[model samples]
Target: MTAAEGQSGTTGAREDERPALLRMRAITKTFPGVRALENVDLDVRPGEIHAVCGENGAGKSTLMKVVSGVHPHGSYEGEMLFDGEPVAFRDIRASERRGVVIIHQELALVPYLSLAENIFLGNENSHRGVISWNETMRRAGELLRRVGLPDPPRTRVADIGVGRQQLVEIAKALSKHVRLLVLDEPTAALNDEDSRNLLELIKQLRDEGITCILISHKLNEIRRVADRVTVLRDGRTIETLTVRENPGDEPQLSEERIIRGMVGRDLDQRFPSRSRYEGADAGELALRVTGWTVRHPIDQQRRVVEDASLTVRRGEIVGLAGLMGAGRTELAMSLFGRSYGRYEAGSVHVSGEEVTTRTVTDAVSHGIAYVTEDRKTYGLNLIDSINRNVSLPSLSSLARRGVVDAHAERRVAERFRASMNIKAPTVAEHVGRLSGGNQQKVVLSKWIHADPQILILDEPTRGIDVGAKFEIYTVIDQLAARGKAVLFISSELPELLGMCDRIYTMAAGRVTGEIDRADATQESLMRRMTVDRS
Candidate 1:
């Protein structure tokens, strides 16, 4: 039987075939006001790369937490079978002891610690309660080589970039003797080259007989490496699909089919249909930056962004396209009044008039709003309520006699929540408890409340699902319809080609090419992106 018919909830394989390495039967989990998972079931064959794709708030993370013992036994009702043996794991350590390891979406490494020390953090290389430094370093080197990381064992985790830290995380998992690995959104923050390397590494591990369960919103990555795919929607298992082993024999799984299963309906277009910008360039300049240069804060001699120039007209959705470390984020932050890096030189103009913005407050007063790429770190206060977050930027307007109007604040928050379609029971819920898509919407809402004529959005839909992406696109179109100058920066070229009126390609801190909507093609953008700038 094919792998597709090899699950309990969806289908089953022939009795003569090998037993599944893991079976999660009738998994039901609940929170105070949410049925996160309801009677969900899954099966994983040994030595296969199984992918789980779902919209945000679809209980993908909850199911993985259950399997990894984050939501321990008795907290949720489920029967788990590992190697066809019934097991109830009391905690994460118990699961790890049985060769089941999970790497969360946010890495769990100590930044100040060295790579070797992080690899064997709690499971150390010790003799008589004394850690053997030599052994730890040797093993760390081997693990690093296994994960294709070239960093030395002595290098601090904080010193490396996000991509390298991810590899080090996998090395840490390897140290635990992982047989079944669960990776949640492994490549969400990665660029093209780094994502390719990580996917290749997952495939390599699968070939070595390690069962992998990958959760990702990127359908292209899922289609690239998944042997079988299981999709969850609204906290329910939709279907299990078998991927074509040989592309020459049969076409791989189509993204359309997966989207249908995920959203429970047909989505004719991945991107919303926007009007073309062939000859529609008559509006006044809404935002303009000229000869913008920023240097690395720690090393003032090293310039990160050099002589970059761009402009956005009124009601225009402009795209900034590049690979990782192309100084896209740095430029955006620097333009938002030196929020990042040391601003060396730049001229900013709003509505065709020069404006002086030296800080975040100054930028806001000058009708500029910047939604950061890392929402958790720089955007929202996770511990605060949603209403508070939404009301933050507009507090001055909502204030009366030096006192905030709580009733008006709540009303404004309610209006935005309804308009954005944020899925939460109440505005009083903490921002941290929400899903990736909802959190992104909240960030946008916060900025929109500021009422900026010019807006900068960096990776607006980075870790969100396709459905959420469509909704975000709709929101952007609405913003543009309201005559806002939107500067959209993303690593996904398809997004730029679909949503933007014009695109500017950045390579090595320089704006290499600019293409109109009609002229923008993935190949053209990529060619400009990889141009030799030395």
Candidate 2:
């Protein structure tokens, strides 16, 4: 954490002066078929931002639930000390009443309600069934400003974007007079600018002396703002490092060092090498999108993807670079046979033949595939087996006489598992048990196993760790080497610049400019992306 320089102590320091505001000692919890926590310990000072880092299924969320009273007291064998006293909470409300607030990764906000109503939903400022509207608005407005949200109290929750909703979560915590706030993957859905802004707000809150215990897969973000970082592996506390921003420090928080601690292995080779493209065979046209435009089906005036032209050919990876809401995903989804929005104008040609773009099935039949960003919601069925998700798009191929051939489905799943290097015990294993990166690979494997000529990857490595990202990159490059067209969209400029052969800069639903990979510097891309907005 860059807040200030403190007395140096290596693995998880505790001040000698006073008891921490919150402390969990030797926390042990077990669920069905898994020992989720094995004597894990954590502490949050009165005003410190203690970050928890780990791969998925690392028991980070389970420990937070233990702390925030979701697990209650007797169910878990642990001693939770808060405010120099042992407090056993039976429910979330029990914790909240005592100034503990937890904002989950999957946010809880009513879509139909206004910001003020959503802010004080269950705990309204009311008297005898009459809501005090003026007082509610005043307090909601204050909390919003504290969290740096630029929204009115009366604005409907569904009308605003996810970034603003994140700020609202922070505001909700603030409203609770929280002594300790737990945020789980708060910035996972935000763009670069919004992510930075949210981090700054977190710092500002820390300065105001509100303790924060945050869980994030983003190592760079943990390096940027965490006062202390606790690493968890296989449901245990591996090590907690007192993260300092000083360059002169012996253990600088570089990507290599972080990955080593997280995975307990040296990940020197991050991305696999790809073959250089030739003018004719390599960049030979596979998919061409010309004069493509789309509008919101209900809101006709809202043009989601405006007159955009792009081309991706065999063995060439064309990257789409833009900010969040710049229509990168919208454009990609719409072109996967117009599955995203109302196609007002456009023509899609696959290898000089006009391809259908009316429905998702038509797009799939026409040798086009799209991998949506959200795996839990759009990509995979969490409750189902991995075999099911991998065979979803091409189920008919594994069916015989309108009946699913279960053996054939298993074979297909096993084949893709080997090809994609998916780390699962069996094809029947639930996708919910896998890590973020593995789940992402499952999403990719599901699409690629369908044998698409042109692939559209939207934020392919959004929430995965470095190790998983490396694996996914290797698979993508291999696909390109075997002669497939790929349209890549990523918020990280460096990833796109490093991996893509060519790039398009988009802003406000339009492709503003194009750049070759050799010439696509981060500064150049940013300038192109933000030309007339200011």
The most accurate candidate by TM-score is 1
In the range 1-534, model 2's lDDT, one tens digit per residue, is: 222222222333335454589888889998656688998877666787888877666788889989888898998887999998999999999999888899987668987899999999888999999999999999999988877777899998877766678778878777777878899988877877888988888877778888889888787888788877777877888776666543223434555555666788878776677776454676678999998899975578899788899899899899998886688878987887676778899899999898777988888888999998767777899888889999999898889999999999999899988887777778898988776767898999899889898999988987776766787898899889889899999888888987899999899888988999999899999988875642
How accurate locally is residue 290 in candidate 1, as Cα lDDT from 0 to 100? 96
Q: How many backbone clashes does candidate 2 have?
A: 1
For model 1, state the Cα shift of residue 229 in Å. 1.3
My TM-score estimates for the predictions, one after another, are 0.94, 0.90
Model 1: ten consecutive residues of lowest lDDT:
1-10
Q: What is the alpha-carbon lDDT for the whole of candidate 2?
A: 0.82
lDDT of each: 0.88, 0.82
lDDT of 1 by residue, 372-394 (tens): 88888789999999999998988
Q: How far does residue 475 in candidate 1 sit from its true spot (Å)?
A: 0.4
